[model samples]
Target: MPAIEVTSLSKTFRTKRKAAGLGASLRSLVRPEFRTIEAVRGLSFEMEPGELLGFIGPNGAGKSTTIKILTGILFPSGGEAKVLGYVPWKQRRQLAYHIGTVFGQRPQLWYHLPAIDTLTLFGKIYELDDRQTKRRIAELAEAFEIEDLLETPVRKLSLGQRMRCEVAASLLHKPKLLLLDEPSIGLDVVAKQHIRDAIRTMAAQENVGVLLTSHDAGDLEALCKRVIIINHGQIVYQDKVSALKRSFLTSKLVEVRYAQQVGADFRIAGTETLKVAKERYGVKLRFDARITPVGKVMAALSAAGTLVDITISDPPLEEVIAAIYQKAENRE
Candidate 1:
């Protein structure tokens, strides 16, 4: 059976609407206006054992709501779903033993206590045997490379260190599935790599199925084999990560510093000049790699002026996602 399964699952929230004036706010205190918002609209997907799937969407696009529903934090408004063979909202206590969750913005570790303390506390909450908890803690500390920081106070640990511990704490009970929300947000490159490596190791060694929600494309590219993108509470694209990149990631950005001044009319075919600092002899250009070969663009720029420095890079992941969203919107 799939680790997670959903069939036309949906959620709607009732929210109070307040008008924008002091008088309106005061009047609303007596009787509040209400609105119904559909946070998730008939979404359906499944995750197999040991699968690393990327669940992504723009802000307010229902990613969090879907995760919350699956994790049993909230009940869905309609349809059916199953996680680890249990209805999350109906059997939340039973399901809790089989799943792990890590929210980047929310720290589960006690702020003033050492991570070890929290780990022990979670062990007792999960009813893990004392001996088993100690062994699991040691194993996780090694896997996450947090053995040295285990005794350090949560408040004193660096963000990266604390995040590593947070993930470790979540896995003390050896969950079969993991729900990760922006696990790499606000992390530096090195720190992000550490967390990614640990997650990869856990999935490989424990065969843990991961449903990951992250804005960082690197995380998806590095860890996920499949990706599902949603917009306006509906899926816009779902495919292998490789296929998504091949279909949409076609543009490259190039920056060049010329040794000699460039003329006002400097131009090249299949490339658009994004910026030019005439005084400093610098120019920025963008082109579709699929339409215009990088070599040809470089050759044209090189011939135009003596080059002091040049750098070429792929377009940011945000732009690629935006283009996908635009394509989806246009199709609708």
Candidate 2:
């Protein structure tokens, strides 16, 4: 059986309308207007044991709602979900024993308490024996490089330090599955790198199945092998990371620099000419997929002027995701 399986899962939330004026409020006490919003609509997917998948979407895209259902924090209005051979909502207590969750915005540690204390507290909550709990805590502290900061109060630690502790607290139970919701939020370059490295190591060494949700493309690129993209409460795409990139990619941008800014009107033979914009430093060319070998484009540009620097890149993922949304909107 798959480690995670969600079939036709759906969740709906109801919002009540409050009257603005006193008289209207009094009237609303007798009868109120309520609207039901389908936050998650018939979403389905399955993950094998030890698979690492990136779950991504824009705000209000049902990513959080799905995660909530999978973790047994919220009951789904429709469909079925099973994690580790147990129905998540029906077997909440049993499922809790096999999963670890980390949400970036919330810290699981007490403000004035040292991280070690928090881990110790969680060990008791998990009903872990002293020896087993101590061994796991020691190993995690060393692996995450938090040995020096374990004694410091959470409120006094830096963002990176606190994050490492949060991750450690979740893993004290040695859960088979890890659910990360924006684990890299508000982290600087160096701190993000540290967290990403730790997550990768955790997965590789422990064989933990991970379901990660992050807006940071860098995080997805670094850790996830497969990506599942959601939009408008639906699963629009799900596949290997490379396959998604190739299927949705529209154009490639190349920036080339010459020793001197070429003033002559120049064009590459095989590529769709997107018109060159020349600045004092270099020329930027936007090309289409019809462009033959990138090597040919490079050679043609080199012939025009001494090539100083060259970089070829894809369009940003945000843009690709937006395009997908627009297409869906047009169809509707």
Colliding residue pairs in candidate 2: none
For each candidate in the order shown, give its overall lDDT on alpha carbons: 0.91, 0.86
TM-score for candidate 2, residues paired by index: 0.92
Which digits, one per residue and each the tens of the lDDT, describe model 1 over residues 91-135? 999999999999999999999999999999999989999999999
- Among these predictions, the greatest TM-score belongs to 2
Identify the leading candidate in terms of lDDT.
Answer: 1
Stretches off by above 4 angstroms in model 1 are 257-261, 277-282, 298-310, 329-332
RMSD in order of candidates: 2.4, 2.1
Per-candidate TM-score against the hidden true structure: 0.89, 0.92
List model 2 lDDT by residue over 168-285, tens digit each: 8888898999999989989999999998999899888999999999877788888989998887788877899888788877577888777876674656776554555556447767
Position 153, candidate 1: lDDT: 91
lDDT: worst 10-residue window of model 2: 272-281
